[model samples]
Target: MSKYDLIIRNGNIVTAETIIQGDIAIKDGKIAETSAGQSLKAIAKSEINADGLHIFPGLIDTHVHFNEPGRTEWEGLETGSRSLAGGGVTTFIDMPLNSTPPAINKKNLALKKAAAEKNSLVHARFWGGLVPENINDLKDLFEDGVLGFKAFMSPSGITDFNHVDDVTIFKGMNEIARLGSLLAVHAESTVICDQLAQEKIAEGKTSARDFVESRPIISEIEAVRRIISYAEATGCKLHIVHASSRKVVEVINEAKLRGVDVTVETCPHYLSLTIKDLEQKGGVAKCCPPLREENEVEGLWNAVANGEIDVIASDHSPAPPHMKEIQDGDYFKAWGGISGAQSTLNVMLTEGYVKRALPLEKIVQLTATNPAKLFGLFPNKGTISVGSDADLAIVNLNESFELKREDLFYRHQHSPYVGKTFNGKIITTLINGELVFKNGDFKKRAQETV
Candidate 1:
């Protein structure tokens, strides 16, 4: 009889606390045992010799736009999950807006859930939408097992998924608090940004820099402060998504000090690429709360280093190339999203570990452990612990490669990161003991969580 179902040997196992030289054994889809220095002597059905590699708990990106159902051409669950698998991410929280019908009601949530269960190669949870008309639908979606609700404080580009105003957001937050659920906000001032953008375009200042300047730090700060007060009043667990600057982190941290149950997430683009990159990359680098100055980027990194930021997600909102026209197109009209699901780990490895000397434990905390805790999937999905799901990503930390479009697993196959070199190549990724991705190939089966 086999003592274990699988064994991975001779790797540096990274967890939230520290990195250890060890071997891990898996059986019946869970981590059964771990050894200090050598492979387990017991017999196993399969084995992976992960010598000379670093094994991390599979990354959990808590924010991504895998626009399924209606926006498949933009980014479907199948190709989206493939991109995630290629990057060694085992789980994600799909945003509510981009999918057809936005997952705001039980029917739409079920539609997206069924689509995910059918096509996703990795595990998925969803964020239900909070808009003016859908306040009554929160309980139904909550009962259907949505992890949280996402509300955009500014205009969500999709007309169907209208952004919430102060009254709606406050009401939604109160209802969510009553249900013991969470609410994530896209913090941007609608009125201020719209006015600024319109003024810029009216004056023919429609360049990338103009677009960047249109969304000011004051807009973000104003929105965040308003939402924090709402959460304070409602006692709702709150998450601020894609926090782009040091001042934003300061505001979030100050709220935390005031006993608010809030956390901050910053994307890879915010940490790695800056206005300089945006200027060079043109429309491809465009995103909401546009890239900041180099000083701002450094300040955000300092926030991550000082343990002020909670999670790091991709915010992988992608569009077809036609909608994302390059330099010749109007930057003001181009799609404002970055297709970054596949490069998050590489970005952190290069920017955090190799360049800035930030600890691997810190990276693990920001990218995996903290996100899992925030979304309530910690022990089962985030850490490589005994009795937890055996989701692992084996990486060659010494390797570096210049990202090519061919290297992208996204349906669009274009990113602000194209041609940029990064370290920590993901060699293999396993989801719930299944070998889903290996050396850029997939096993091609949907992940079903029991």
Candidate 2:
């Protein structure tokens, strides 16, 4: 009889700390043993030759907008999770906006769970919505297994999910602290953005550049300061999502030094793309806390390299093409999002490693390890250690390919990264010791349970 279920041999194993040449033994979907530069003596039912490939932990994207149930036309759980698996992601936490009847209360959480049970291809969790009206709903959702609570300090771009004020923020923070759950905020002050946007519109300035200029760095920095103060006063663990500005990073670092229980995440778009790129791509590249200048992009990269930023996520918000009409090219009128879940790892590898020379271990940390720890899915989901889930990605570091919209698997074909050439390619992705993607094809497996 075979002693192991699967064996991956002759690969360079990369983790947050070091890289080693090893052979991994997996039994019943868990890592059984890992021997450096030597194959296991026990028999195996199946073996994969990973010669010349880099094996890293499957990515955990803690922040993604998988618009489903009520908003399937925008993007559904099926397509969203498929794209994630194709990019080497094994776990994802869905945000509570974009979908109608967002996951704010217990009723909404149940509805979202039912939808995910049918379409989710990998392990999934959800975030409860935090708004003024939903203050009473947080505890129930937390008890119901929501990973955290998500609040927007500014208008969330959707009317049903309203923005929160300072008063509501304090209340929500206290509630989340009581539940021992983290609060993730979209950290731009609506008061500041609304004022600037109104002034620009009055002046007949609605171009992409004008939109970027309207929401300045100060708006983000001011909101971070406010949230940090509240987090300190209430003893709430806070996570600022999609942090864009260098000034905001400085504030977060200072708060951490001052003993605040806080962390921050930056999206791949902010790290790889810039205001100049946004200007050239127009509405397709638009996002909230819009892309910053080239110098600011450099500062964000430095933060990622130095570990000032805690996690890197896709913020994979997607919308239909009708909403992002490039012909109109009016930034204020276009939908605010970017579709890059399937391209995050490759884009980061191309931009962070090839161009900037950031170490591969750091990329593993930002994309996989940190996110798993933050979302309470650690040990099992983020590392390649013994007793962990056998979820891994085999990467071809020397390969190169140009990103094309038609080649993507997302429900919407539009992408901000179209025509960009990337250096790394994911050759095979394994979930629970089973091949899910390989050789440009997706292998269907049994639906995963939450």
Provide backbone clash counts, one per model: 0, 0
lDDT of each: 0.91, 0.89
Error of 2 at 124 (Å): 1.0
Shift in Å, residue 11, candidate 1:
0.7
Tell me the TM-score of each prediction against the true structure: 0.98, 0.98
Q: What tens-digit string does per-residue lDDT give for candidate 1 at 180-226?
A: 99999999999999999999989988877888889999899999999
**Cα error of candidate 2 at position 30, Å:** 1.0
lDDT of 2 by residue, 1-450 (tens): 999999999899999999999899999999999988776787799999998999999998888888877889988998888888888888888999888889989998888888988888777789999999988888899989999999999889888898898999999999899999999999987888999999998988888888998888899999999999999999999999999977899999999999998999999899888888888888789999999888888899999888899998999999989887755546888888989888889878988999999999999999889988888888998989999999898999999999887768789988888899989889888888888888678876676556
Instruction: For candidate 1, report its TM-score.
Output: 0.98
List the candidate 1 regions with Cα displacement exceeding 4 Å: 326-329
Clashing pairs in 2: none
Positional deviation of residue 395's Cα in model 2 after best superposition, in angstroms: 0.6
